[model samples]
Target: MSAYAYYPGCSLTGLGKPYDESVRAVFAHLGLGLEEIPDWNCCGATSYMSISGDKAVALAARNLALAEPMGLEIVAPCAACYLVLSKAQHTISGYPEIAARVHKGLQAAGLAYAGRAVIRHPLDVLVNTVGLDAIAAKVIRPLTGCRVAPYYGCQIVRPYSGFDDPLRPQTMDRLLEALGARVVEYPLKAHCCGGSLMGTMEDIGVRMSFLLLKEARARTANMVATACPLCQYNLEAYQGQMRRAYGEDVTIPIVYFTQLMGLAFGLAPKALGIQRNLVTADPLPVTV
Candidate 1:
């Protein structure tokens, strides 16, 4: 029953509330507790870094500062938030001058970050800490007939280097299989879902998302599973918009890996936040 400092990020609280609910419900069912860091702020996600380097670093550092005092490992459900927070932690810890500047900024906010805490995506905890064998043991419903396309998005594992195998990531797939899902090799698993471009440059984002959805359907996959809040939000929220843009009525369900795991353990769909999704993909029972 290990617990980590959990940060649900801004999107999970707003645009991806379903993700937050599903992850919480799933982890709780798995006997893990996620302690929300008290007085936490946004990790400077997609916009802050481009706005100003100093502000971006400072904003992310504030989160580390809050988590360090508790001496718990930091976990982020959002890929963008996870990357930004991990990058800030690495940057400040690697450079003395930058560390000093960041400390000053933290002081202004009345926060002190030692940058000593370990930051990881929630999927890492699910695979590494919780262990696949434990997950296998609890799978009351094996996803035998279900074929899942494991989508990694772009930010969570990449650029962090060694967080996951760069070219070949098996974390999500292996976990899914342990829970009895027939994991399909998805070529666009690590491809970018065009992020915030869904709003600005709708065409490109839709094309990217549409292509991925097409690949899943072509592979005979029943659903797409993801570990990031943004990936889930972007892929799920934009399915209809992407269909309209592409002039086709495509209905593919995008889900968080945690949600699938919860279902494998025989947790009800309502408990895992399945009903809140904008897309309509039914959770079929695991035959095995």
Candidate 2:
């Protein structure tokens, strides 16, 4: 059994509670142990970086410092947390000045990180580390009747290649397939979900979300499986807004890949947090 330092970011504890629950449930089902990083703080998401690069790096590095002692790779379930942590590590390692400042910030917080810990997203851990064959072996209830659109949102694969092709990722799609789901061809899989733009610019955010949902519906997908909490929230929560704005009723359940995995693993629906979903009209087509 492989162990990892799990960093469930702010959103996961809040609006993305189901994602957090499903992540732990799926990992436990797969015999993967996750140690929660002690005293973890916010990753600063997309806001702090825009305000101050040095401070943002420091904030992200603080979490890395916390995980370094665990001596295991850190797996962040939230896409924004993964990106922020990855970007901070890359920037701090590449630039001496930034590293120095981040070190100082860590010192102020009574923490120290030597960049020994590697940051990874759950998708990368599942497909690359856990192996699809191992996952397929544990699928007790195959998702044979479900047609899923695997949505990758924007951050997980981008600016940090190697794990997958950023433009056309197939990790989630392949995993769903292994679970006996009919994976729909999602061309806009890597497109942005407007991120914070959904809050700052409602019109643009709703429009972008509508387009993605529209594409998924066009392909006859019953539900969209995502690896990012923000993407799940945006796509699921914004359907009514999109309909009011564009007169297109695109209502589909946006579920976390972990939730799907849990179902396939024969875990109870409540354990996977399926009931916490905002959009409950189109429930997951999985049964115990």
Number of the top-ranking candidate, with lDDT as the measure? 2
TM-score of every prediction relative to native:
0.94, 0.97
Residue 279 error for model 1, in Å? 1.7
Q: Which number leads on TM-score?
A: 2
How accurate locally is residue 106 in candidate 2, as Cα lDDT from 0 to 100?
91
lDDT of each: 0.82, 0.89
After superposing candidate 2 on the true structure, give the runs of residues whose Cα lies further than 4 Å from its correct spot.
281-283
lDDT of 1 at 224: 95
TM-score of 2: 0.97
lDDT for predicted candidate 2 compared with the true structure: 0.89
224-251: candidate 2 lDDT, tens digit per residue? 9988888998898989999999998998
The digit string of per-residue lDDT tens for model 1 on 1-288 reads 677899888888887776788789878877888899987888887788888887788888888888887778887888888889888988897888888998998898787876697988778888888889988999998977779999998887688835687666878988998988898879888888888887788888888888888888888888999877777877888877877788875578888888788888898888777778777766557221
Which pairs of residues collide in model 2?
none
Backbone clash tally for model 2?
0
C-alpha lDDT of residue 159 in model 1 = 86
